[model samples]
Target: MLDSPLSARLEASERILVAGAGGGFDVYAGLPLALALRDQGKEVHLANLSFSRLESLDIDAWLDEDVAVIGPDTASRDWYFPERALARWLDAQGLPATVYAFPKVGVRPLRAAYARLIGRLGVDTIVLVDGGTDILMRGDEAGLGTPVEDMASLAAVHGLDLREKIVACLGFGVDAYHGVNHVQVLENLAALERDGAYLGAFSLSRATKPGALYLDAVAHARSEMPDYPSIVNGSIAAAVRGEFGDVRFTARTRGSELFINPLMALYFAVDLDGLARRSLYLERIEDTVLARQVAAVIAAYRDEIRPRPPKAFPH
Candidate 1:
């Protein structure tokens, strides 16, 4: 007696883990979902495929051979520690306070690290959250839009033995900078629905508490690191503020005008098991131990496969 597939899977889950599939600010995309789910009284943990230098962290910070516990107090000479930055913001808001960070590694080590984290947290549900829709690409897209880290998270978590694993992408129309085609993105989602992997899509409203908090978090992150503000969140924030096409926000998009449309505010979800089953090349990098190795494997597979023609929005 489940109202929806996502609810049915999440029904028995007591502790949930929301992780960023891609490195960098991708974890910020999970803020709204994490906040909304927290409102339902579920215990949630946040983690990320971090672009930070985990090797530089002190031994005490290491939770496992591959994972590190990042907090607001965590210090680094490196300017790009998204995990610590997020932890700081969470602390300022008196939220969960600690964010777990996994190094940008391949499927083998990444999977091992994820298994350890799952064991430590006793997590019943693992949600792979992506900042953009690129994670939906099924290996035959004309462009995969920086698939390395996203696919690594996908393959790594796919190898885990878990009751419920889901993928929820928050920001849409943001990966176009990396040449992702949204028409093909829709086509892949339709195919996943046929395979029973598509979990349905929802939009984030700025009026909601979670959405308002998310907007605040994104704004705070931008203020903390103005030079490297997230284009994805900027677009999503603009859409939430009721902006329309071709609106300008950051200097990065000065030459290339952005389409600040509503789609950027939506979250498209799918079943991890079904999505893994549909992958044409995930198996190729299963044994990879380095990020470069994973990239090489995907490149070779794309070279061998006949890619689907890129489609454009007909409207």
Candidate 2:
């Protein structure tokens, strides 16, 4: 029996795809949920919008024109391949090591690539995961905080036909470094709730098996790429361990002060299509073929609207 609406929505789903909506270490944000679901005997697959240079990969790695299959042993010219690093870590744990990677493209081609993958995998449910809450930002926010990749993924997946489409975000306040306002994030979530789209929140604890494995995976990834450790996941792992107030897990956040509170460990979910429809400019980037084009459209949209001034949380 599923207690939360998020779990209830996914209760009937047997084959689930947990894909990173934002590129880079965003897929790591979905690891705990994927691991927990897999432990329940559900078939879960992992994928990411890769920041790596997919063109440098061999032809055999290509699952489609835009999708690449990255395994533990997949060769790559770039040293910073998050997908490959994650695959290697999963392999070490005796789990599935193949992670599907989609090149950073605009919505049209990205949606087509997703369609092909969905058909091939026989996926009935898709949970698009974002490392931070910035994916919840609407166009009228004071700052969008690097929304190109996240929006593209949302727009693409929202168009797909599936039994369930969900959006989940971890590392709540981490996007402040990227100029996001947490007050707005909360306000947007309130709006989503009013629309019957918001799913209740839940926390991950180090006491759980999935949480322990997630900590191990993040530590392993940090050791693999010390120079480029994921600040978001590191903060999240810290929160799960009951840490608080400016916890520094890596040198990447050495200069910036962090707030590693319990909120950072919580996962907030919403209906994907509801979130997409609330985005004022999603339609503007629908025809974009390149990532830069989506950025340009968002920039233009921002210029045309007077952004709501950011507010601080009232105690």
Candidate 3:
């Protein structure tokens, strides 16, 4: 189970946040994993910034069925229920958590409100998926009357110290149709970090050859420093390839060809909910006992699986 090398740091976080850009459908991908963690008795939360495409989907139907409406036009209903229902479901599962989907509010109040809530809740770890807001914030370097650094700045502003906290990133190949590819996304992320020590990430459903190359790279790198947080790759490939005991990494189809973004997205959400609630950690070095149990099941098929390369389609 330790073979897949998911981040060990994540197991130690209690407060978490799953964040991503608005256009991609990764959030929908994350829902089922979040639900599963609830079944395993972990607290989790889901957060999508306001104006995210995720907010425009059919919240009512998704809550009822946990389905994703990949395109904005497929189904229409009040999108509020999914967020509310997710919260209600968490409570029902004996996990105390909330889901916050932010809207495209004017810069001023949105920053203030975000900081206030984080402060009130005392968040710990933040799971960022294909999000550039952290880097964008750094490029702008304008403070929101709250000390903002990087994406981690959000937590810092709310008085959440991340020096000892964990941040999990299931960063992977983005939808070929939505945004930059996986490599480009990581290239940008590398530019944003000063020390690579705290970052942990994993890949999902990339083209087969590249996925294998990436898996090999991350695995070799992480095994060397077993103490550093694990950066997982290939798990998405494993999940999709059915190497991990029929468990799914994605619950819904992504706008991309592979339709594998949701599993990674929801996994981040479940982890964040646990982090935000302080249920993901155990002794702060080892991952929270609750999270490790799940990762154990998830990490098993590292060798048994391989992703099928995406097929070329006629233009």
Give the Å shift of residue 6 in candidate 1: 2.1
Highest TM-score model number:
2
Model 3 lDDT, residue 222, Cα: 35
TM-score of each: 0.97, 0.98, 0.41
Candidate 2 weakest lDDT stretch, 10 residues: 247-256
Q: Candidate 3: lDDT of 46?
A: 59
How much RMSD separates candidate 2 from the native structure? 1.1
As a TM-score, model 3 comes out at 0.41
Q: Please, what are the lDDT tens digits per residue for candidate 2 over residues 1-315?
A: 449999889889999999999999999999999999998889999999999999999999998879899999999999999999999999999999989999999999999999988888999999999999999998898889889999999999988889999999999999999999999999999999999999989998899999999999999999888899999999999999999999878877878898989999999999999999999999999999999999999999998999999999898
Model 1's TM-score against the true structure: 0.97
Report lDDT (CA) for all predictions. 0.89, 0.94, 0.35
Per-residue lDDT of model 3, residues 199-243, tens digit only:
434334334443343334334433333343121222343443435
Q: Put the candidates in lDDT order, highest first.
A: 2, 1, 3
Q: Report the number of clashing residue pairs per model.
A: 0, 0, 20
Please tell me which model should have the higher TM-score, number 2 or number 3: 2
Off by over 4 Å in 1: 1-3
Clashing pairs in 2: none
CA-only RMSD, every prediction:
1.5, 1.1, 17.2
